[model samples]
Target: MTGLFTFGETMGLVVADGIGPLTYARGFSFGIGGAESNVAIGVARLGGESCWLGRVGPDATGALIRSRLEAAGVRTIAVPDPTFTGLMVRYRRSGEFAHVDYHRAGSAGSRLNPADLPPSELREAAVVHVTGITPALSETCRAAVFQAVETARDAGVPVSIDVNYRAKLWSRFDAAPVLRDLVGLADIVFASPDEAALFVDEDDLLGNLAKLGPAEVILKDGGKGCVAQIGGERHAVPALPVTVIDPVGAGDAFVAGYLADRMAGAAPEQRLTTAIAAGAFAVTVSGDCEGLPDRAELAALGGGDLRR
Candidate 1:
């Protein structure tokens, strides 16, 4: 049975080796990045069982993404599409700051449809991790995300949603209602402060979100930490202090850590502790999913690690 399940697009990442523009970079490396996939990989690294469902092109970049996720121990059920695999480029500029460029429009990932969601697999999952970005990708992709959530809800499996809203995908005014609908279906909801503000004011964000039906709501405040309301109880946790490296996948890493603890029946405080630890580690590395830590590694990180 799947302990944790996440679905969305995973794209090939091209990262510059040094601080400069993409054109002037002397060397580059490849990896994979996506909110859902990053969370899936983080869960796997923490020794939790997780599966990823989606679409990928029948091409080399797609092969790379599949091989990496499998290597990280995430179960994959990605369908093959004839279009090119989606890709993203990352460049570090002026120290810790990084910029990412997407080349994913009309790619195989955006072609996701309801047919890609397997009912049996959804039924087997202990929890489903859904994202707002998939719904904004394309009409068909939106249907697939909705189908996955409905399948999980009908199966009595918990659903977690991350409002990873991307402005490039859709306008906020257009996305608010859809996002609000998704939040209502979630057992647990995660959103950055700005994302939550898209629908509700800062003061009432958590309360207003809870009024939508989720049992839990998390508002990520970046380096300041996160505030959550779980089953009508309020909890707040501060972010772990770590030197910044790359911040791209930190949020996904946090979700994975939280899920890892939740799967183990941890208390709310413990869950957020592990989550903050995971996020701290994520920013210390350059790649999206590479910085995630396993159980032992997460434990060892409490005191810190020193490397030359």
Candidate 2:
């Protein structure tokens, strides 16, 4: 079975080089970013076998996404579509703030359909991961996420979900039920305290989410730390101290860390430790997935300078 299997829309990213207004930005760099693909790359970097299934426009941007995933050791199951690929433009408004604009409505990625999933792949996956962002894209994309989750579940594959709520994509009123249902079906769930509040009371966040049916529920508190209930046992792990370069993909990195370790047969405590280490690696670099650590890099995280 594949160590990890995921499907979602990955967009071409155009980011300004220096910190300033978009109008005055001097240079730009092009890359790809998406929740599922980021996790796939992260798992692959940590020596886990991962595959990504998705649709992309028949354009250079789509090609970039496919090439990058393959180069990172992720198997890409990409389908060509007629609509244009999605794009995200990001620029630092100031030293402390980054502004982002998405151009995904009616794009090929938002056109994902349930028919695109391969049932054979779902059946052979060790863990199937989904994010709430995909369902918020469009009705067809929403159906696709459900179909993927259901197929994986029926095949006895573990289902993992990240409640990656995006205010720009949907309203809380519209997203709550869908996210709640997904959480109910997931075997493992990842959510922030804010995201959990969409379904359950904040007083007993993880407990309420677990009542929804997941065997494991994790509340990611960003730099502070994370709390989780796995197999009915509570585990809390503090975040590692690291310089924050860009926190864009840290959550995905954390998910990948846990999933990779779980697939490698690590205990719950060790899984949390690796997850924290992976998140620290993500924030120490600028691009999404660029700093995801290999086993060696993770081992050398707090080590002193190398001897030549």
Candidate 3:
């Protein structure tokens, strides 16, 4: 059985090879980066059968993303458009501080429509995963996400949502209401502490989010670790301390790990531990999803050893 199905926009990422502005950089490296795709890749890396549904340009960058995801064992269903694909430039100074520039407006992925999705593909997945990013792309894409979620929910397939808030994309007319409605439709919700702080009002962000709707809620707090609440019981999972390399896709990695564990019938506490370990491994490596660990690597991370 397939473990997960995710839909979102994947863009070509250009990163400066050395510490300087994009204009002054001597060279660059190219990769793919997108919240939903990152989580799908992470799940695939952990031996889970995951599929990614999205749109891309009929260009080399789009071809590269499709090929890379296929190589990583993720089943990709990509709709091709004539427009140029989205591009993001990442700049780092001293390999510490970082900044990103997005050139995604009018990109191919943003042109997605509800008609692009195949009903068969949406019906076959165990869990349908989506994020706040896709809805922010465009009105058509937003409608498509709602349709996908409704289909999945109606078919008795659990829907998982990652509240990946991007302030750059949020406007007065978008975001808040859409995200709240999506959260209500989701069976499982994942949120970073900072993102939760933005939407919910409570001293304990995790607790507040659980009250919002999702049957299960996972709260990620970077190095501070994570907490999982299910059936009114809360379990705190401590973070695994590791040398930091990059923190970009850690949250996505954590979601993949947590889902993988849940698929294996692991308890909530165990799932939380695996999730934190996955996120810790993610921050220790450079690339977005490349840092995600396999099943064996995750198993080797001793329990409670993060305190060391």
Candidate 4:
């Protein structure tokens, strides 16, 4: 069976209960959040096989991450380490403002090395998906990502990369060269217009990104939908109209949708349609992976509410 293989840091998340000052918030909800792992879950929910590999601390939080991924139908390869799992705290400061704090420096996930990936899985996967977040974590993690991409290339597997750049993690000066190199190595690349500007000219974002070497280039423009160049085809897919309760994880969902269909040999237009629908579903719910829709749900999107 065709599958998606991914690796990255899945961190413990602590989110304040209600909107307002976190100090006055009475309670918090615990969950897991990670870019690659979220994509794995999204693919699985869309009826595609997916595997996630990462380093996890010897703590309850780490166990929770593994369990959650398993529940979401993703195969997990969690490496145990003495270092603590990473943590991210999020809270809504107001109706429109949300604040996030990261406590992930030197965490176990940051300790990922090239040795963590199994050669067998790397060779067998239909596509290897990675994100900019892992390489930004630490030197070892960066090496691991590079190693995975190289290995996938050697095996003739397609590599998909999402430039999910976090300004809080590293400055553009430090990230530009590294991300540009990764884009050059990828078969398919996903990024926002702003993120693409970090490496290419703002005038022709899609054209410039394709020039960097990726045969497939996608600009995930959120509510504006996406503009993609796949092989010799150019697509402008629109987003499904929906009330967006939370916008986080929508990119991961979009990536997952495209990859799942790509693995199934779907046409470019169908792939983009599924990507847009999945992203629309993600924004209608809360949490990182909880909102990812399955194949059946994708069919019901934008239709009447009553389902027997």
Candidate 5:
């Protein structure tokens, strides 16, 4: 019952094999990338039982996504819809800059509805994690997120939310209020400094989040580490230093690490430490979930075995 549960969209990822524009790129690599699913993989890699709940299209891309999820040790509760699967094309050009194009309009993931989530599974998990990305996809997806949060709350389960705001999906003015509403229902919330600023004008971002009804609020600052406000106290943990290969999916790994530790009854500082390490591990790899470390690997990483 302490397993992690998450609901969101998983899309087929087409990454450029070599450093060049899509027009000039000779080859491409296929994988799956999604906030909630990545978190589920992170939890699974850290030795936690986790499940991914979402809808996919009856297409080859959907098949690929599910197979990848299963390979990552995550239990998938994927429903097939008539629409095609969502797709994300990532041009990993060079350095910290990458061009990404989303073709998710009217895709199966965007058509997520509350009816797709099974109540038995929703009520069984220890924590239900969600991201703002799903809600921004469409109104039905937003309703599904709301329903999932409500169901978790009603069944005495904890809810975790990450304010993964994307300007490409919606404007700040439109997203702020909706995101704030989701934050109000979360027990644990993760956000960057910029995302936190959208909710309140306070300099104490974590403190401001606490006022919004979350018991724990985490503020992640890239390279600057992360801070947590939990149980009427505050703790800060520094991120590990590693040469970044890809900047994407690190946030999901961090969230997964924290939740896995929290579920294992680890202290706030320990959770934050693992969270930072997981994030560091993520950026050092190419694929999203490929870089997530196991419990043993993460432990060794903290012990200064920096040779990877």
Candidate 6:
């Protein structure tokens, strides 16, 4: 049993060194990536008892992901299956942008079914964090997510949802209904500016998302900062300026930081500040969740307000 629990696919990432297309790149670095796992890692780094639940291929990539997560203090509950592991290849061009090529079809995570996750494990969690991406994997995975959410809700545990909308994963027939349902059940909801724009059809993004079912809503805007609405009182927090090395996992870090602060009994305004600082710290480091700030580091960045 852990204070925080999250479940989703964790994919192996191969990022090209320097700047070029994946085909032309001669060097690559290996890492693990997934929205839920990233949040678990962030929480673990902040000294929280976080557990990650998922299915992975009984392969080297799965082993690596499990090992790395355990090393970061995250308890991993992985179901092993003999399926090809999911992989993502990232291409970067200096002064330009980065793109990802996903090879996730028929991957082990996409094969996760409700039977794969034990109800006992989910029942023991204090808070269950899920994201929109997991449901997009496959029908069985979608069912698993719904079951997990329902189980958590039935147990009277808090459920946090991140609406990480990836257009490439879902056709028009898939996303809207699923996301809408999830939002209606969440206790806390996190979404970026662009994602919020798509989910809640309003020009004033944060204002629109706040009206959704979640008692607490956080709208993250890169560089510009973040805004939160808790109990009808809104707070806006500015982003800390930092030299960014990579932008991946910033949102996950923010969610983890906010949750950690909330669990620590911090005020809503302080939680927003801590979340912003955590996200700023994440982008300054190379790996996803690697740069997530500990309490001291967070305090140095004015996140000390969390103690108020």
If scored against the real structure, what TM-score would every candidate get?
0.95, 0.97, 0.94, 0.97, 0.96, 0.94
Q: lDDT tens digits, residues 105-206, model 5?
A: 999999999899988887999899999999999999999999999999999999999999999999999999999999999999999999999978767788
After superposition, candidate 2 runs with Cα above 4 Å error: 302-308
CA lDDT for candidate 1: 0.87
**For model 4, how does the per-residue alpha-carbon lDDT over 1-308 read when each residue is reduced to its tens digit?**
35999999999989898889989999998999999999999889888899999999999999999999999999999999999999999998987788999999999999999999998888899999999998999999999999999999999999999999999999999999999999999999999999999989999899999999999999999999999998957999887889988788899999999998888778788888888998999989988888999887888895211211
When 3 and 5 are scored with TM-score, the better candidate is: 5
Instruction: After superposing candidate 3 on the true structure, give the runs of residues whose Cα lies further than 4 Å from its correct spot.
Output: 303-308
Candidate 2 Cα lDDT to native: 0.91
* Candidate 6 clashing pairs, residues 3+ apart or interchain: none
Which candidate model has the greater TM-score, 1 or 3? Answer: 1
TM-score ranking from best to worst?
A: 2, 4, 5, 1, 6, 3
C-alpha lDDT of candidate 6 relative to the true structure: 0.84
Q: Which is better, 3 or 4, measured by lDDT?
A: 4
The per-candidate count of clashes, in order, stands at: 0, 0, 0, 0, 0, 0
lDDT of 2 by residue, 200-251 (tens): 8888898999999999898899998899999999999998888898888999
Q: Which ten residues in a row have the lowest lDDT in candidate 5?
A: 299-308
What does the lDDT read for residue 112 in candidate 1? 92
lDDT by residue (tens digit), candidate 6, 1-308 = 45888888899998888876566788888988989999988887776778998888978999998998999889898888899779998878764587888999999989988998778767888778999999999999999999999999898888999999888899645787888789888889988777776667867666666676778988888898988888877888888888888898899999988888777777898778878888988888877666777878888876644242
Per residue, candidate 3 scores C-alpha lDDT tens digits across 1-308 of: 46798888999998888776667888888999999899899888777789997789989899999998998989999888899889998888666688999999999989988998877777878788999988998999999999999998888888899989888888634677888788889889998777776667759776777778788988888888878788689888778868888888999999988887776677788778878888888888887778888877776765312211
Stretches of candidate 6 above 4 Å error?
304-308
lDDT by candidate, in order shown: 0.87, 0.91, 0.84, 0.91, 0.89, 0.84
Model 5 misplaced stretches (Cα beyond 4 Å): 303-308
